[model samples]
Target: MTMTVRDLRPDVRADAEGFSDTRRLALPYMLSTPESVVHTLTHAHPDAHFGQLIAEEEGEIVGTAQISVAHDSPEPGQGSANIYVRPDRTRRGAGSLLLRTAEERLAALGVRKLFAWVLDEPDNRAFAERRGFRASRSAYFLRLDLAAGMLPPRQDPPAGVELRTGADFADDPRPMFELDAVTSSDEPSDIAVEFTDYEAWLEETWQHPLLNLGLTSVAVVDGRPAAFSAAYTDGGTRYATAMTGTAREFRGRGLAKLAKNDSLHRARAAGYTEAFTGNDTGNGPMIAINKWFGYEVCATEVRYVRELG
Candidate 1:
């Protein structure tokens, strides 16, 4: 049976649902919903040229790929193609076909380097290696049972510190943006990124369908956002902390921990039963912080990179 690869249609609800289902089954730790999938498709930056692909066999969607350039990076011509096939449907030609199509699309766009994330399992790792991708950084996916887990006792912010939700800055989110810029710069990654475009950030991050401003906790110091725990939800019960960080000057004050803890508390109160987050394996402090909140490492993925001539 021949497998076919084609672009995903955001307007098609079935396509979005199938894409989301395949992603969730292939990567149980990451949060992917139909709405989030569509949001990404609609709001992708022009430079990124983001595209989603689905592999079909016998009219069934079995594999998916999210292809895009690293437009935010200062370096040009770098792209990423993250492909995943339904666990039960692997060993079929769907995965290979999807990846080939994605690579072709990216290469045509002048992409000189390609990156991918492969599960830290033998078959997944071998697949990437066979395709010329070399292992890079590794990250862990963590899960917390919000309903049953016991979080660290909430602590009062020290003097001059205040807690606010992301919604508080709805009228003027510049401070939050600045804080995000500073914190994101410190993130561990292969591609260095700078969040310099405020308008783009508003459209891509702040107004994203999955971002729950009401539950995203921010730590304020001297009337400015000093730390934040960005929250994302499925509009159902699952909650994920998309990013949690403190400004460089605010480090050691536990502001990030405070913000994340508050967000987790709010998430549980709102009936979100499961919480998820990811951290680079080298991010020891963050791993320790999540462990403090009863989060357990559920899965691991290794980043792989390939040079395209």
Candidate 2:
């Protein structure tokens, strides 16, 4: 069997479908679609130098990698390379070939520190350790069966607060962007990211193919967005929370929970049966809120770092 790694052709429908299928099979807890795969490649910031590679054996895609520099981060020389091989097609040298290609590409882009997420399995950890990558932080992929799970009863916002949907901000989404920027800066991660470019956010986030504006819920205080839960759907039975956060000044009031709960109820009503979300283990408050919503830790992944010369 001939194994080769090459850059994905965004215009090719087969390439996108193959890439998305491999990712869905390898990481079922996360959502992926052909349209999303194309959107990510075309809408990424130019400075990010984003590229996606696919490892093909004969005519079938066996592995895929998404590589990019942390252009929005204040820290330079930081990059990410997430590689995944079809579970049924591993051990055929696809993973190693894809990693080698990813590393070479990232190194040429001036990456000094590379980061990757490995599933918390013995074999996966061993593979990273063998490649000189050391584990740093861990995160959990939580799942809730919306079909049978009992969501908290809907509640009325406080006297000065009101519940709104992302669709309500269509005429002017600058407020949602502002709230997202403030909350994203506080998220726990090895790399600190700043969302300074509103246009970039609009292209890369707000306008993404999976973003479900009608299902997303926001908490508005005095006509300003204070907290929000961004929802994404596969347009099928699966739904996910892209992000749920509250403005700094509005913390400690359970606004985040309120927004997320409202979003979940809307998702269930829209016929989404499964809900998935991820959280860093260090984020105690968000973890507590997910647990309160009856979400269970379905899987865990550890972030690994490797220094490049």
Candidate 3:
């Protein structure tokens, strides 16, 4: 069967569905849906130059790729192209074709450095290595059976601290944004990011379709948002932690754990049966916290970098 690569048509619902379906099948631990796919494409920052591509084989989608420039990063000429082929459709050249097309598009936009996330499987690593990509860092995908696992019992906040839902900041989310910015900057990653644009955060993060504000928990210290666990639900049984972190000044106080535990409990009460999250391999603190909540490592992915001349 002959395979061809093309850009995803945002106006076409089937295209979004196919892209989301392929992603979910390829990376089950991560959450993806038609609505979330479309939302990402439409709300992406203009400077990001984001584009989604699909590989089709005789009218059937066999692979997908999301390519974009790291516009928000202070460093220039850095971009990313993440490609995934259906497990059953491997060896058909769909993954290669999609990646080639993505690289060409990003290169045309003056991107000199390209980054990708490849599953830690031998074949996946080999495929990327053959394309001049070098492994940089790794991260693990974790899963928890919310319906069957034993979650740590919720604990009361210590004196001078209060627990609240993300929804509590609906009228004014600037504090949430501030806390997210500080916490995210501290996350371990090969590519450093700074969330400085409040308006962009409002459009891309706060207003995201998958974000479940009611299920998200925040730890407030003296009326200030200090730590939080942002929740994302698929409108079904799957729940995922989008981001969990504590402000630098409040790191040792266990506020992050407190917030995440509350959010997990809320997710269970709301009927989500499964929970998922990811942590960089070097982030031992977060990994330990997830293990305490009964989350087990389900899969691992290696970050790869390639320099284009």
TM-score of each candidate structure, all chains considered together? 0.98, 0.99, 0.99
lDDT of each residue in 1-309, candidate 2, tens digit only: 999999999999999999999999999999999999999999999999999999999999999999999999999999999999999998899988988898998999999999999999998899899999999999999999999999999988878989999999998999999999999999999999999999999999999999999999999999999999999999799999999999999999989999999999999998999999999999999999999999999999999999987
Which tens-of-lDDT digit does each residue in 133-173 have in candidate 3?
99999999999999999999989999999999999999999
Model 2 TM-score relative to the real fold: 0.99
Model 2: weakest 10-residue lDDT segment is 152-161
User: Candidate 1 has which clashing residue pairs, if any?
Assistant: none
Clashing pairs in 2: none
lDDT of 1 by residue, 53-143 (tens): 9999988999999999998898998999999999999999887898889889999999999999999999999999999999999999999
- List runs of model 3 lying over 4 Å from the truth: none
Off by over 4 Å in 2: none
Q: Of the candidates shown, which would achieve the greatest lDDT relative to the real structure?
A: 2
Q: In model 2, state the lDDT of residue 87.
A: 94
Ranked by lDDT from best down, the candidates are 2, 3, 1
